[model samples]
Target: MKKIYSLLLLVVSCASFGQTIYTENMGTPTGTTLIPAYSTGTAPATFQNSSPIAYSGTADVRITSVSSGYTAASGGGNVLINAIAEYFQIDGINTSAYTSSGLQLSFGINTPTAVTNLLTVEVSTNGTTWTPVTYTPTGIGWTLATISSGIPSSTTLSIRFTSTTASQFRLDDIKVFNFDPSCTLALGTPTAACDAITFGLDTYTVTIPYTGGTSGAYTFTPSSGTVGGDNPATVPVGNIVVSGVTEGTGFTLHITKGSCTYDANAVAAIDCKPANALPFEDKFPYTVGSALGANQTWANANTGDSILAIAGSLSYTGVTSTGNSVSFVGTGAECQTPFTATTSADSGLYARFLINVTDYGTIADASTTYFATLTDGNPSNHKGRLFIKKSGTQYQLGLDAASTTTNFASTLFNVGDVVCVVLGYDFAGNTLKAWFNPTLATLTDATTPDLTSTPTTAITTLGGFLLRQDSATLTPTITVDELKITTTIAGLLGVSQNSAIAGLKIYPNPVSGGTLFIETAANAEKTITVYDVLGKQVLNTTTADSAVNVSSLHTGVYIVNITEEGKTASRKLVIK
Candidate 1:
């Protein structure tokens, strides 16, 4: 009875814990396959065919059979060709298999390639008269081909090719080939438990060439020697690898036949566990001035430095010196995994913040907190601006009106309603824009979006500042990385925040007097807390468990505070 009661109590506690921590912020893709590689006859057996030779000619593919008479039976036993679906460009495709062709020979198959190789095809207007569809150059590799001009306007098309002048003809390999895309393989973030894992895969789009009569069986399975993980499901022309892949530090997805295999940053390899659905980011509680331990900052904060921390916490004494910059410190950040911008658009530093948001304390006060501090009036009379601090529910960017200048304004962002937020001041246009996710904020000259909010000249000259999150109230749960601040919008688009898994999240935001669940990683030791609207701590607890509770709290708007080690995270919670 005692054991059973304890177990039931534990379950209840977990349910209650979940009620307090609502996972909202989602992690970005650690890595993606922009361009994958595909090849004919590669190791790990990516394709199959009866007698398809791995297309390997440097130029356009060509095949000549002497006594075949353009007959399928006479050719080298039905030519079966298979190529990795995603990667490769078709160079050139031309069929010349006939010796005074009797009837118009036409056929083709549309697989991952541009089109099948066959003739005797035609296009009909109303199922009556048929017109020959013009042959077009497959975009795979061929650069020059103006054959798509005479294409008929009918879905039903038949083609017929007769050897009028020449009695002999030959066919070559479809032209398609190109370099492979880049890839990275890693877990949410590299920590102790499961950080030393990796996975590699290929990706690309292969254009088919040919029309009709090209029939054969095709299949796409996981590459050979795949130590584990579900195999890729074969599609009409592509293959989708939808499985939780886990590999040790040295695992390799070896490829053959000139196929490009990218080490896509799947997750931190450590967190690559099979789940019912795609894994979401783990949510951490948030607080201020939380201790994130040592090694959060670089040995010597300077240019060309990097740092690595999921929920890192740090504090700056003052924004002093001319060439000062704080960043996530680590070698991987410096070498293997450089930071990229949040999206391909927008302006900011790579994954980390450049701390350019004006108005830290209401625009007039000249005090920098968190990673930067205020300084005396400068030649430009510019007060420094502190960057964003990721809370459990919102991202605080910009300064309070009184902190920097009387014109400073900050932007707060939440999940779903706002996935990404960029607080920027465009100097060229004298504009302050706060873009949320896909929602663009047109500069309307409002007080919040006023261009005079911050000393644009001072902020620009600072070349931006970098700060680590340090929560003072309870424990901060939010995690931020890939912080970048830039003047040019083009530079911001180049940042990739999806590198580190950043896999932290909570669920059921705005809890209504029920269970609050928090799901996070094994290596994370977090502290969870609850607060009222008055900024008073109501509940505080710390454990390695994945859930928390707030059922006892009053029914109203509250804040959940999470502190891991010293890094604090906070999110607003509602009790029903």
Candidate 2:
């Protein structure tokens, strides 16, 4: 009688924790593919297919199988790369009513004996930061795993489930609320946990839950590695960053705060592919007066009459340029270059090119005419698009994260001026970042991006980049050169691996005047050697001051090689 009474009291107390905030069955996958968005929800959310950055080549289609109820599954083949991950985001979920309240998340997962990779659950409030709270059910049959966490009292709360990896697993029925069965602490660990690589060492960051958290001092212990982070704990209930972890190692994390001990399995980093090959880079290396699209490695919709290869490629600050430029107009056809699919963990595809709008169509038109866009598997969906719409005297260079025809970022551009564009999509964040004529410091630092927008439509994967030739009444005549797309931003801009030799910049690339500056990260003395396209070394000088006298060089295309601290990088230099 005494035991039964105590059990009943505990159950009643846990049940009184809170009410259901939001719940979703996630619907059923229409055959093999999971639907991008549920059209019924009032709350905002985004779903995406993600592959680890370490993986090389095209992304696999987000596969699903149905035995009865629809569930999310994974494709199998490669032993190393394994199956890609799925990211489900619950955005702007209002939890203001549950101030200082604890929350619970429950999901149903069923895996087969063949499925090897484990399912990891990560929670977050803001989109950028994430905390791995618990591991989902690993049982062979349908097993429900309910994890609890202290959710912050904000109207813009977000919970993310990263169905990281699997081959024969089925994940279905996800729900989030204050409590369903009770307020029991099933998997209430830290609210936030993430790994950061600093100087080749991996650091683990854990944040204390806001509402029902430990008080005073806490303890952290690793299974195999040495534990060194702020010993003798400061405030015990705040954020803690555990350091001194070796890279590529998995371990169990144990945190003790008074009696409420929290323990979970963790990895310094997820196991991913080792080498990623360069996707595509074209300087328009075609014969002068030759056609562009079809036979020239660039794919176009028609006979490729809309584009013509012109002489001399445009130059940017830190990137290498070669071959010729392509002049294009709105002629009904579109030219596209498909690269290796980007499954970047964070920022998706990084695209950089030099563009000069020669004519801004009609001055009275304000309707958007898209020029460049990052396309997906679907031929109709141009995920992230760049447009030029006439606004008053000048034209506004606009960027959109989705294929939406209307809204875009506004930055003025002139007729004859050359503009270097750096655009990329963040698959994990579901946002796109764009920059106009950014400097070496600007690109490397990743601050002051001209525009950033969340995707208006649910785009699954980014596979190619296209230059659309819209109607002549909409788009302007433009010249494009030195186009490159890759997995990483550093790779896209050709940034050096060594930090000391990074941030290389050359201004006024078509150097017509007297002096041209070559800058490096350390600002040390560097050797400048100029070579003409004929492979003849014309000028060589060593200078500490980042300046080179280009007056001696002739008016033609030349290669300027700069060696800083024994590290060499060549940039295409044109002296007029």
Candidate 3:
């Protein structure tokens, strides 16, 4: 009995000898979402909420390294990564009571086997100044490691982990404490999206799912929107909602349970832009070989095979070819064009674009490839996607509300054929409709659509358009140009009929100042009026010369409406 009591006393003495002041076992991480920091557990131990780790250096994530069943993970990283965990104060620690020689730090580590690869730990009171304390590992397996060499001379502590060599490390059970009398240490994401706008209040309600936290009825508060929902509960688990959300803004949610709180990963509210009023068109009017997306209307254009504005344009039956067009050779990065946003109440929205398939690329068996989609502000949420599959040497076009395997067209169209494709969405009906090369009389909402499809899941919002360049196997040299999007079919047909005499070309588009050249088939007398994206008139002038003095216009996207006699041609212009 005396021997057992002595062992227990020795263990207690060793733990308290280090004066375990702060310890983080690290909170249990769930799901595949990479954890940004240890924010799940209680305060002082777990750095969260008020204490956030600047996990910006590299891919610092909660990894599922093997644990003998204690908790699931440790902070993990790859080679040559530097990360900083911000400091916070514990309630009872007195900095004056401890000295640099008496302080100790301990943690569990599992590192890569490279002999030169090492995990260097640095301590900092303020984030700027740092002191290195080395904890070299002897093996690749999980090892409880401790070191007490160099310590920061501050009450609170922050840590920076760096590895200069190509190695990996798992950090867990971290402790920063002392040797005299004080006590010892211990330790511890949400994807938020729009739910719906409650009918009565007419405000957006958001739902966020979290991976780490004590499971209970928690009241969630948004950093921007208010908390409200129908079939209400004071605290909601699984389902929580927020109202009055603003679009095109940075958004974050705070979860509260009793006195404890957790902050979810930051996300933005999808821009629920108003439905387009004017006819929005992009003729790919930039200089040939000029890559899309920098100071241009397209977003993420430089990502894929470089969404470059290649020479030439797609000529449609009624739409005259003017500027250069964009093509998809295979798949690389997805690109977005912010044209207009459609609300849930909107029933009709239409888009028309010219497509010409030069040749088909490698496609998986029985699988179709999507080239275009109607997306929300967060371009990932595709509302209605346009798909195409190869049927022999020819290609078949398809449409879906949100499905990849949506049916393809029965009529096989040949490659090298410039075809006008019109895709539309009816939110109230939850239907995706399309028409191929329709004349003015045939292009009415009342007329039966050429292709019709219903979505498997209901779509609520539509804010922009996205071009798919995502798959390597789904390769096809598809050229697209003369794109136009609007909420009504009248908006699609509102442009004046294309006549040879009235057909005009604007170039070295992305007018580089000097003089903006507008070339016509006749070079006839014309009056030009330019309007910005918001339908605000920026430039208006009557010029008989094909070249108008557009040097006065600032750099932006503008719609140049050139009127020749009674006929008018509206084209998109990007002033560089």
Candidate 4:
């Protein structure tokens, strides 16, 4: 024998965040004609104060039994015999306010027998071609249905309930309410600080606009770093401190309430430190045709192939203050140098270089193209990277570290702009900072860092410093000069002027015959030292005579330091 199932549609008025467009209880006097806003069919049901059964209120509408219009079934269960078609519609329903999830249509039903083909709920705007609504309950003890078929676009919408079986059917407490099962999450601005520095513990606050779900807790996940100070199991919508964040770290807040969920993302802010002295400097004073072989200080001549050439060329022109500068065009052209002070315990180091970007080729969004990098030879230990790429029409500076990239400052760089870039690492804080277009005279700390990375694991030892174009498609022409790496800021800017050596003068500033004449105060023991542009000590001598032979030195710019009676002064010496 085949099993039979009966459905009882039960609807109740319930409070919800969404607005209720329409509702009806059918609590009218007995023997009153059941008149909806609109009606159809030759014969319709009448409103009865007491029906076969009332789920809630005192009255309901009933479909009377029919005799002849029923149809026989093919499969041979209980045939739908004497089926009567009737439609009672409530009009003037504006469904435009409904969200993409649609609204709920509910009503109470009282059926006497287990009839398979008994009733069907439908809706339409023109009242001619109706759409059927599936009977799916969403609330407890209530027969719920959704208008998932989408309500008609007309203002005069109508909902009709059709009964087809001979069994009498009753409906009451019809309601149309919004079914919004989603929430809105808002995480406001979060406070941030440098590593180890205290500022309210870098706490942040968040709030949920609608918390109407079963899940009470929320989870905070960082994109590239870790977060702490709040219980992950039962995090609420309030102040929660964040930690272990590095530069470019983004956070996502996840919340689940009942059957709904919401999420939001935000970034943390950190401050940058100033530049310090470096152990190496390079001015690229080699002539145009000179071979770019490895020098005493540099690890390699120049590596990588140019995009437009078969081999990378370090031969470049357009000298600025110095006699020469290195040019990199196309892709992969680069220069690298090795330094012994690569350990994190070196405290701090600064690397500064002057660059003139003549072109910034077509670039796609989020595509990284590097201009300079400091690495520890090990691919895993990428100390820091400085990059500039196109973001829309403007070029922006970015810093890459700890496996994340972050853009800093609103200042945009364009083609033909000559600027100095200073990259520094602070071992004390384990952070990286950068400055763009800094004043070379004073080497003042960039008021605001172009970019800064959060405290990370200290790079114990560095292998080499590199300047290259990492993008294949980016064919930018850049001239780099005056590259310097020092451990103190004053060393890069200039030594302080000494008043005791004011009367001393160096004659034949641009000496050609390799003979330098120095005029010093009488009866003073003076010590002189000459350093190449690379900060390499080339010549040192102590003399009472004024004339010094420099024939052994090459043609270039050098810094001459003179010390007399505990007073020191520095002068630039140009060899021709």
RMSD of each: 23.9, 21.2, 16.7, 28.0
Error of 3 at 479 (Å): 1.1
lDDT of 4 at 435: 81
Q: Write model 1 residue lDDT over 121-207, tens digit each, in one string.
A: 233334346465445434332122212233332222222232222112222111111221221111111112222211112111111
Judge candidate 4 at residue 419 and give its lDDT.
74
Ranking by lDDT: 3, 2, 4, 1
Score residue 502 of candidate 4 by CA lDDT.
48
How well is each residue in 408-437 modelled by candidate 4, as lDDT tens digits? Answer: 556787776667777877776777888877
Model 3 per-residue lDDT tens digits across residues 93-156 = 2344567787777666666666443566777776677777777665665666678668654655
Q: How many backbone clashes does candidate 3 have?
A: 12
Candidate 1 minimal-lDDT segment of 10 residues: 1-10
| Stronger candidate by TM-score (1 vs 3) | 3
- Least accurate stretch of 10 residues (summed lDDT) in model 3? 1-10
Alpha carbon lDDT of each predicted model? 0.28, 0.55, 0.58, 0.50
lDDT measured at residue 187 in model 4 versus the true structure, 0 to 100: 32
Off by more than 4 A, model 2? 1-279, 344-347, 361-363, 377-379, 444-446, 495-576
TM-score of structure candidate 1: 0.21
